[model samples]
Target chain A: MTVQTPGLIATPKPRHAPALRLRRLQEISLGYLLLAPALIILIVFEILPIFYGVGISMCDWKTGAALGVEGWQRWIAPCVSFIGIDSYTRAFTDPAMWHSLLVTATYSLISVPVQLGLGLLLAYLLFQKVRGQQAFRVLFFMPYITSTVASAAIWAFLYNPDKGLINSILTRFGVPEIRWLSDTTGIFQVLLKPAGVDLPSGLEGPSIAMLALIIYTTWVFVGYDITIFLAGLGNIPAELYDAAKVDGASGWTLFRHITFPLLSPTTFFLLMLTVIGTFKAFNHIWVMTQGGPGDATTTASIYIFKQLFQLNRYGYSAALSFILFFIILILTVFQNRFAGRRVVYD
Target chain B: MNRDKLKSQLTNLGIHAILISGALFMVFPFAWMILGSLQTFHETTLGTFLPEQPMWSNYYDAIVAMNGAKPCVFDPAAPLDILTREKGCMIVRYFFNTMVMGLGTVLGVLTTGTLAGYAFARMNFPGRETLFKLLLATMMIPGELTLIPNYVFMVWFPTPESWIATALNLPNAEPHNWIDTYYALIIPWIATVFSIFLFRQFFRGIPNELFDAALLDGATHSRFLISVVLPLSKPVLITSALLTFLGSWNALMWPMLVTNSPEMRPIQVGLRSLITEAGTQTQLLLAGATVTIIPIIILYLFLQRWFVEGISNVGIRG
Candidate 1:
């Protein structure tokens, strides 16, 4: 009653589908094998350590003890011992920590804008085909490559009160030689001393030591900013400038219309990096000041380091580190939110 | 019209002068450091821009002092006990330690990071996205957070209470702590997330078709990676290696933390102690600084092109 298809011969559904799926699973397993080393290292060294750090923050750990679950005694032990949020309370309430925060903020606030502005200006000047630009670039970029410790040491010598070149120069100009590093007195305070302007102690500017650090840091990083700006400048088409010239847009107009907008992304990047770097700064502070002269240059990182290493206050240091991490995090997020929106990608 | 041209020419000359001055300002520290190294101790402390008398002996003294042999011993009975010791420098030893540690780190980072980067770039597996994100998130945490835990690990690893000696079945491990050992420096920095991330980004930019072609040609994943991916990623590898080397070479904090003995100390830490000891010897300190800077300068000169290109690409991609 029905015609049978001879060649097709009532083919049973292919039974190799499951086998194919199994082979696909095997391929994925191979993929995992390929990625396992990196993932394992990241998990151990980076990700797990952060959570471990959080756990350590809750503990009263010492140098000898293993940083295991047993070390969480400070956070968990009951009526006889438990200290809930005490370390955090100590860190947040500590006046030194607050002072450190203020110092860090002030340093970042002043240095970021100046570095970015100068970097952009330099990039622009270079882009204009100034003579010996390559030599100039190398000169500016030289500081970034210098070791931070060496540079700090050099700067420390320069800031020395006696036999410093700066002091000698000041003396030559008929100005009084001011104590640079050892002076905890702020610049504004010194300036206002001659005038009868009474300012509150807290309203004084950063200590001269901190000022020197800021200057050194700015000098070290300005070239990096300039390099970034130069790269950004390269991305802009020459036609944009050509068109602006055709429209009689010269000097300020050309920069305002064509260059600035195009360089926004680089500016945004430099700003974020500078903020993060300034917040996390430690090497120079450690080498130059050791947070000395009554904590004038004790940035958050140095404060935390002192607590952890110098004083062996593990829990408290961990808490301070977390606070710093959050401050940087919040600033980074804010920067991304605003700067990301404004950056001209094209 | 001719007068206008003259005025413009004057303005251009003024601009060039300003640029040259700025360049000089930037370069002055290096210039001074070099000049200071050539001066006598007295001349250096006097802060002369140019050395009054160039003393090549300063370099010899610096080298000898850093060798850390024949240390000056003082008796309180002698009036000149307060004078500086003419110790032979141990800088040679410190330099060796730094090189070994630096190379060890470079090897570890390159090997592990390459593997990880390849997986992240070319492979699609379970938990891949989540793991990558976790890796990125770790970068947000300040490094200080992990410092204590890592220290604890280094001090306590291979044992619960005893040092690594008892656990390793090695004789006389009880008294000696790993704190001042080179292992302390090398083990902690082996897993570099930044390098892994950098290599991953670079690898991702490589085309997928190459991998497929290699696969069609029946090459195994490992072979394909070694022959194709590694060669293709040479620029990034060199860049990362140089950065890793420089970072390890210039490391002050971790080495300062772990190593106390001068015998095991790296150059940065050694330099710190040297400066403190020779605080009065400005010329010697300058010579030490010069010695430290020379290797870096040479490396930079040799790899300048790769450095610029690598940094730009990494920065943009990151």
Candidate 2:
């Protein structure tokens, strides 16, 4: 009976059972007829393409011509001898592929936590019954809905080392200009260099350029998280808080026992979304860095894009994307298994 | 009691201080965008935070600078080596193309989504639950997996002219495809799972009494959907339309892949080209960025209520 589960209708049983049976037959056909256009498009574009992508990943595909067949045969078979997971095997050894995956993991690892923490804090602050709360909420949520390309362009201007505002302010305090977008040095290395500490390459962490992207990404998405968190905070029963307060529970205690547990489902939902979102994120990173300054910011999506568009390595790119797809699928299922159980339904 | 009130007041003030600063950080880039767009390139290079005089002409120059863009030209022999011809200010054209794409996609999504949603919510059918579950499962698939294959399909699929030629058994037709066409941009995006899901959820909320009354009046399902259901579902219709259009307007990667033509390019692509081409001309680039985002900002302003409510529903309900 709950509204959360959609697509259930309770139809009262009608008299004249034969007529009702005839009506049921009509309903079945009509239902399918209604669904035809959407189903056709999903099958053609969404479903079939996954299989097509898998096929492309296994072949020595460069361009359509490299598929090396004419007429409808091109559709059925690429006509070249099947490469049989060669591209996938090649990717396993490819350092660039590994680097991109590492970069993607670092991005997700950093931005997701920052966004969740900052979003929850802000949501709790706003939930304190402050005046002008709605206005603040709207302001915070603006960036989430803005076009990433445009917003990233704006951030690029903000991050411009020479004439950018950040550098200008830093220079006023006699701090030197840092290349926010173009710097390839890891942030840890940058922070530690003055102390004569040099971390090894593997331990350097995400590059300064990647850090800038992560910051911008966090800025863009935290609003969504905050808004969702605010909605979650709103859903907890007020009586629970009242009872806890009457039992002499302090603010932190009340939040710990009542609010946080109740908000766990929303937290879990956002975690899943943010994980998937960070992996698939492209527009802003592409605009700001284009996987540049020596591929420091090249997440897996950007890596696949470079292979497909710039290098035209169709088979390899397809293979790389399939690997990414499996990673996301596994991460999602893993989270569902491990994290979903703790969610408070109420 | 007085001390407790004072402590709570201090805490409230501290919270406000934090929230206001956070809000300022969120809005700072947008403020910088507007300021940069109005300044001269020389001033931007010199790190002048504010313009001496707001150069409204930067917008004009940004528009005019778009004239240098080359339309993506593809001949059958060299599909990969896209060529270009110099054109006029593509801002207007890009806007028009984006509008067409947005409107077309919205219409298609709403039609397909509403019909399917209605059927799923209100009617019983064979394989109903299974099909619906399958639709939901597709939502989990990362779009990157589909990108290459979809691009391949768009390029390799036969043209309608070729289809006609083959049917008529005529001499071989030119090798034409969906690349750089409206068909490539609009059609593939129309059948999104999210739209179907959104509509289905909303449709399920409508009371069954309406349906029963309509049935007693001998109204067909289609007639009932059109007359009784749609009229009452205004808010959902608007929500879906807004979302679909916004998504289409904001699309970048897909449009960039399927379209390379200057005329076919949307505002986002045009703005991206500006960034690359005007690498040093920060003022003009910002101006172009400002222009591209204005429509969405305007839309957001008027429909802010629906935007928040719809997004909130997505979080809580989904």
Question: Top DockQ: which candidate number?
Answer: 2
Every model's TM-score on chain B: 0.83, 0.86
lDDT for each candidate structure? 0.75, 0.84
- Compared to the true structure, candidate 1 yields what TM-score? 0.86
> What does candidate 1's lDDT look like per residue over A1-346, in tens digits?
4533322223423685676466557668877876676666567656666777677676655432433335434323223323557889888779999999998898788888888887887777776788888778877877877787777777776766776677877888987877777778887887888887767888788877778777778778877777778777887899988988998888788888888898777678777878898889888778878877778888888889888777867777888888898888898889889878988888
Q: What are the per-residue Cα lDDT tens digits for candidate 1 across B54-83?
A: 888777677667655354344557644323
| TM-score of each candidate structure, all chains considered together | 0.86, 0.89
Candidate 2's docking class is acceptable
| Sliding window of 10 residues with minimal summed lDDT for model 1 chain A | A4-13
Considering the two chains of model 1, state its CAPRI-style docking category.
Answer: acceptable
